[model samples]
Target: MIRTPKKLWVMHRIGNKLQKINNIIKVIPEWRQRYIVNNVEGVNSKDLAQKWASYTRDSSLFIKEDDIVGIEDESRLLEESLMDGELQQTLISVVGMGGSGKTTLVAKMYNNETVKSHFDCYAWITISQTYIRDELFRSLIKEFHQSRKEQQPPELSGKDYVELVNILRSYLDLKEYLVVLDDVWDTNLWEVIKVALPDNHLGSRIMLTTRKEDVGSFSSGVISYIFHIKPLKGSEAWHLFCKKAFSSYPDKSCPRELELLASELVGKCKGLPLAVVALGGLMSSKKSITEWRSVYDNLNWQLNNNQMLEVVKSILLLSFNDLPYPLKHCFLYCCLFPEDYIIRRKRLIRLWMAEGFIQRVNRITPAEVAESYLMELIFGACFKLY
Candidate 1:
């Protein structure tokens, strides 16, 4: 039987989508394998530790001040909060979606000499989602001691959890300390760890950087402020993009001929600092308009498949992977819509129910469940409801 042209076109589109799905399935396992290998038990090589440290280190150490754009107001406000807050130990958090410069802004303040001088001692601990309790205590102990240029205790490794907690409490009891808990994922971890930090009422602070908005208030019993970081503005994004993309050029300015292409590429980043910087760095070495045009044409493919952009991909994947199983399905279903498509709320919910991505709870309807899922995505910065 002869097939109609429309039917043949439909079959081609389905085939293409299936191929894309297959590629995504293949990449997921590779990502998991890499995580396991890197974080596996007993992988304690010094070189490996240093490599991971570099990855987790505050970007302020390596990133030039000139390259940091659009955060001057945020930096000043965060500094004021850190410096002039109540005497009681307060939990101040900088919350934002991943890659929105939460860590960078906090780190800049954490490293500031003026900020450091206000506190008696300071410690900066990077917390992972699956943090080992004893390991975290050890890092805290080391940072506290090292910040003062003093040697960490010789028995640090041998100490049990209780002993480590006691040591931290004793050390920080009388001192006004500024502790930065970076990249926090678990509220329970904060609940448990905060017990070791004494409230000396000497204007101490526990500053946190988290992607989750609720983690800050949940962890705080005293005054808590959650500073939400936003993506760069249009001009700021352009300035940052130029800084990275044209680092070798005088004034870091785009050439007149490539202005339109550069703006298009930067616009694709949607003012997300990490994406802008990553794409800028990726384009820095390519000198010709042809190369720039090639990159612009395949930008989406590069975001997903390019190794150079892995940091941006990994960050976004963290938010996606943190979603519940059903929510993940709902989120991916939404992605089937074309980019910049303004999906109507009720229609999207109905589509979710039809797709069987929403499950009914005992009291809640499937529509309610779908709405909650959409809100979760919005809160998680996976979706921007306009």
Candidate 2:
């Protein structure tokens, strides 16, 4: 049955309210205190409230909402995993190309107030291609100390890896902590470090961000919950571009003809935010439509030379390289579609099917085959689906 708009809005509000209630219940301290008699008994109501407030403030994690673009679904999934009971795995992987906002999304989650209030401790580490165990261990320990000042002897070893791992495990034996491993590349590095992390701690969450899907998949054991970051939608793409290109949104006063051309070029970026930002920065100060056209022309010329046109070409290359052989042909064939053209999916699929890309794969329907191909391209961030 079709639901009315009012009913849908009401349902949405109720869902949000329930989520907030769940978060409050999960993060609120277990016991309430009346009065402090010698430090063992209890604290005054005002002092108790002040202490709880400090704990809540200190434990918070979140990315500023303004800095984040989309991925509300991604944020919620990570939160739920972190909030699950003891033995709940807090590991989440965010995978995408460089500059595709994997770090941004994870930062948002880590800096969220709910995350801070819920977890007992927290850590953030940036792991690069060259993995340094000592550096990572030190960073985690530093965050732990900063978050909690109980100042028990430091738990890591200076030379022995085994002793260091043991110390880490002891430090977080039963603590609920959120750890973010950012810019990860090596799979084996994770295997070595996973042992040191605490297990079965309620509300504990870990997040991983990497450019390669294999890095994310291997680290997290190919879990069902993989959040693949896609590029921006058209409106989002335009909004981002305008923010970078003009001090404000470009309208008729900002040269309608040039603005129209800029919009077309933005569409060519396939809604990738980095691409939008880079291209906008490149063309922002130009007053002539001719220069915009020049950029449009240079894009093709750069593709032919294929040496280095900075970050944009690098991103485009990654997208192209990730495609399968047949899919490559299918995508290259899309060069036939004009800039800013809103190609109909059914029509495009029929065309590809006629061209013989979608056919008798175990007798699957043509529409299904087309849909699968589209999904693959979407996953690879090569194309945007409206």
Candidate 3:
């Protein structure tokens, strides 16, 4: 059976301790295989896909907050990029770390009344890492129909993929459109998505958001249009913390008794809005000051006991376990390089081949095979693809 999250966390406790035993390698894979056979051998494709898709949706929860704490500058920049362009079909990219309010900011712009009045049509699509192009087009077409309530667009349901793209292009003709493509990970995704979107030279614009700086740089067709979103500052973080922590309270502020503890908890969040908001949500359910103190105390205890590192290891372990067997070896082999080192892709591929991590595919060279495997890990959100 696969290790439980708790069991895996225990393994994290002794990961370095057992490194001297190379024979443990053969034992672990055998254990994993046996676990897979006993626990997950018979899951059907439909169920697996459904599980993965549901996980994707849950992971990318688009929370539209009642209070937007501090994004006025971002809001202005978004509008100016779209409105001030000289019918040049500008592309604006918003890049930030996950859970740093990238989606919240974009959603804010997507619903802005002034921005709404400027564009003939508005579209927002969240492209999960494992997105299907056909479903993507269907979503676009449906959004287009909804955006224009005047006419019932032609029956896109009966149409083929090519026909659907053509219909979407036609609908987007000449008139200005504001389209937001969120959480894009693959360049191949951009290739297919760009076809349906016509520039039209009508001051049309595309707004994109991603967590990777490299992906943002790649999508920025023009050099100077990317906006790198910083994490929330201390004051902003505290404000958001208070907003969520006392959501049940009329004033949305913490009581004096709990303010110090709340500040300590918020400080631990490291200015990440997602962490702050989530802590707020948890604290909102707390009935008394003692409970808030208890919550912070447990978290503080975990930090002191290095259980936070275990939690982090569990997250990275989950990502590590998702890789194919061959790719797993190559990825782990990357640790031989120095920390913060810049390794060339071609050089890395050669090392992977030498280490026998690159498997022989039908009519594919080892280099090609290794490169594709490396890319699968990178675009799978395991590593930043610089």
On TM-score, who's better, 2 or 3?
A: 3
lDDT of 2 by residue, 309-328 (tens): 44455434444554567777
Per-candidate clashes, comma-separated: 0, 14, 1
Model 1 agreement with the true structure over 1-386: per-residue lDDT tens digits: 99999999999999999999999888866755543323223233444423332332233233545667888888888888887858988888888766678877877788789899898889887775657788788888888898899988887889999999999999998999989888888877668888799888999998898888778667647778788888889999999889888989999999999999999888877777766766676677679999887767666565667666444554344445556899878766654442323467877777677668887699998888888987765534455332
Q: Go through the candidates in order and give the C-alpha RMSD of each one to the true structure.
A: 18.3, 23.8, 17.8
Local distance difference test, candidate 3: 0.67
lDDT of 3 by residue, 1-386 (tens): 78899989888878766774666775767755543322222334445433332222222133444556666798788778778856867777788876566776777788778888899988777675667688678778777667877464667567788987888888888779988888877756656787888878788888888877766667434323788778779999898878766877778877888888888888877765656665665566677878777777667666677663432222233345546799777766654442223357877786677568888899998889988997665533344332
Question: How close to the true structure is residue 333 of candidate 1, measured as C-alpha lDDT?
Answer: 61
| Candidate 1 segments exceeding 4 Å error | 1-61, 302-311, 314-386
* Error in Å for residue 36 of model 3: 37
TM-score of every candidate relative to the true structure: 0.65, 0.57, 0.61
Work out how many backbone clashes candidate 2 has. Answer: 14
Q: Against the hidden true structure, what lDDT does model 2 obtain?
A: 0.63
* Deviation from native of the Cα of residue 171 in model 3, angstroms: 1.8
**TM-score, prediction 2:** 0.57
Worst 10 residues of 3 by lDDT: 52-61
Error in Å for residue 278 of model 2: 3.3
